[model samples]
Target chain A: MHFEYQVDGGNFSNAGVASSQFKKILKQLNVDPGLIKRIVVALYEAEVNIVAHAYRGIIKIDVNIDKVRIALIDEGPGIPDISKAMEAGFSTASPKVREMGFGAGMGLQNIRNNVDQLDIESVVGKGTKVEFEVNLG
Target chain B: MLVSELKEKLNLKVFGGNSGLNREITGGYTSDLLSDVMGFADQGKLWITLQTHRNVMAIASLKDLSAILLVKGQQPDADMLELAEEEGIAVLGSDENSFEVSGKVFNSLMQKS
Candidate 1:
């Protein structure tokens, strides 16, 4: 199965809609509880990243018999250094975003920890694309 | 322990999601950083934080958390309360800080076990 969602940048109010919906789908499909938790965490972090930093984004999910893949593509000021962005405490979020209890720089790291595979591609002044997959088997 | 039990035991104020007060609580996590809780907090945990934004309800619901306990007498944003009601994840309030609230919750849950 495949699903796509549009993420509105700077909209904290609707940040986790995709993750929540995807979680329900996973539950209905009877995915393992542990795997579902990991996928939901990764998806939620990715969703928050777009709302906190990007201008706008798209989230695409592809679920197969053995694995699930998530792609988040955003049009915004891309990361200048992927390595730095992946660090635990590095963030470019504005003070307003931080005041909402996010932008602590743990977003990507959390994605990495929860997903089996992670690929991040970015171009300065353009946009970014993050892809991750978790095995359901 | 159930959320209603915790609220009664800790004397927490219910801010929203009264429908979910019967949800079960397996554990508790206290963190102000949304990502920290999203990354490390487990399912069925009650999140204790000072954040009172709508995103907190999103996180709580997405994480399948038992409830959210706002510390230091913090109150939820109007939108946060609305989302909590919609999502059915209890939003609670307390006059204590994270340290005190977490400690008390831990002790109470431990006693239950």
Candidate 2:
């Protein structure tokens, strides 16, 4: 099964809707419980990143018998330093974003922590695409 | 502590998913940030926080949490309540802040176990 969701930027309240829906799909497919948890966490962290940093984006999920894959593509100024961005305590969120109990710089790290494989591609001024994968077997 | 007893101790108003709640109370973690809560909270503990967003349900679902308490009398939005209902997560509302609620829950859990 495949799913796509448009993530509205800077909207803390509506964030994670995509991940939540994706989780349901995974459960219905009878995916492994541990894999489902990892997929949900990775998807959610990426969704929060799109909401926090990008102007707008799309979160996509592709599921099959063997693995579940997630892609977050955002049309925002790309990450200048992928290393810093992946750091657990590194965050560039504005004060407004922080007030909502997010923007603690854990999004990328959280995604990396939960997923089996993670890949990030970015251009300085063009955009960023984050891909995370979970092996179902 | 039974989920029913924690409800009374914190004077919580069961706002959603009353029937789906687990009777077990393994422990609790209090955090307003959904990210921290998602990373740290165990599968059976009551999650105490003032954050009443859909992501709260998302995290609770991911963690397999027993229930959620919205502290400081904060009420979840209509959409959040509906989502909680669908997800089978008990959403509780309380007049206390996260710290006080955590303290009370910690003491209760210690006493029970």
Candidate 3:
């Protein structure tokens, strides 16, 4: 099955809606409980990243019989340094965003820690594409 | 111990998730950082925080938390309560701050266990 969700930047209130919905779908599919938790955590962090930084983004999920693939593509000020961004304590979030207990620079790392494979690509001023996959078998 | 028993012992106020009063309580996690709680909190813990936004409920639900306990008399936003009610994870409160509530909850759980 395939699913796509749209995310609007700065929409804090609706940030986790997509992740929650996808979690329901995973439950219906009877995905292993532990695997479901990890996947949802990665999906939610990625989803919040789009809302926190990008102007907007699209999340595409391709669920196969044995694995799940996810990609989040967004339009915004692209990452100038992927390596630096992956650092656990590095973040460019404004004071306002930090007040909400996010933007601590742990997002990408969290996504990486929970997923089987993580790949991120970006341009200086255009946008970014994040992709990853997890095995279900 | 069940969430309802904790509420009674601690004198917590239940503002929503009335149906989850019987949910099991595995432990307690106190933090204001969403990512920290998401990363470290285990299933069925009661989250103690001052954040009153809807995202708190989102994290609590995603983590399979038993309940959210608002500290320092923090009142949850309307949208936060709405989601808590829908998710059926108890959203309780106390007038004490994080430090005090954490102590009381810790002591209570220790006595029971």
Candidate 4:
């Protein structure tokens, strides 16, 4: 199964809706609970990053019998240093984003830690694409 | 231990979820950061955090957490409470700090075994 979600960056309240929907689909598909937990972690972190930092974005989840893949593409200020951004305590989020209990600089690292595979591509003047995969097997 | 016992021992307020709902909490994770909570929290465990944001509830639902306890007497926003009610996730509030609440919850689970 596949799902596409348009993340509205304007509303902080709606940020996790995409991940929530995908989690439900995974549960109904009888995905392993551990894999499902990892997917949820990665998905929500990626989604929160997009909403908190990006101007706007879309999150897509593709699931098969053997694995699940999530891609988050955002039209936000691209990270200048991918390596530093991957560090656990690096964040450029504004005060408002931090007020919502996110932007703690843990987003990228947390996503990397939870997923089986992680790929991040970004251009300073353009945007970012984060793709992660988890083997359901 | 079930959510009811946690509520009674902690003297927490049941801001959401059916009070009589029976669910066992095997462990606890407490953090204000959603990312850390996501990466560290175990499934079917209790989560204690200071955040009252909507995504907190969303994460709890995704994680299949046994319950959520808002520490330091914090109350989630109305929308957050509403969503928790809809998702059937137990929501509680306590006057204790996150550390205190987590320790108490941990001790409670340990005693039950």
Q: Can you list each candidate's DockQ?
A: 0.91, 0.61, 0.78, 0.78
- lDDT tens per residue, model 3, B1-113: 89999999998999898888899998999999888888778899999999988999999999999999999998989999999889998899999999999999999989999
Candidate of highest DockQ: 1
What are the RMSD figures for all models against the true structure? 1.0, 2.4, 1.0, 1.8
lDDT of 4 by residue, B1-113 (tens): 88888788768899887742477888888788777777777778888888887788888887778888898989888988888888888889889888887888888888888
Per-residue lDDT tens digits of candidate 2, residues A6-49? 99887877787787777777778888887777777778888888
Clashes of each: 0, 0, 0, 0
Chain A of candidate 2: what's the TM-score? 0.94
Off by over 4 Å in 2: B15-17, B20-23, B75-79
Q: What's model 4's TM-score?
A: 0.92
Q: Can you give the lDDT of residue B8 in candidate 4?
A: 85
Q: Worst 10-residue stretch by lDDT in candidate 2 chain A?
A: A12-21
Put down candidate 4 lDDT per residue, A77-128, tens digits, no spaces: 8989999999878889998888777888888887888888999999986899
lDDT, candidate 1, B15-99, per-residue tens: 9899999999999999999989998888899999999988888888878899999999997899999999998999999998889
Docking class of 1: high
lDDT of 1 at A52: 87
Tens digit of per-residue lDDT, candidate 3, span A1-137 = 99999999999999999999999999999999989988999999999988999999999999999899999999989999999999998998889889999988888888898899999999978889999999996
- Where in model 1 is the C-alpha error above 4 Å? none
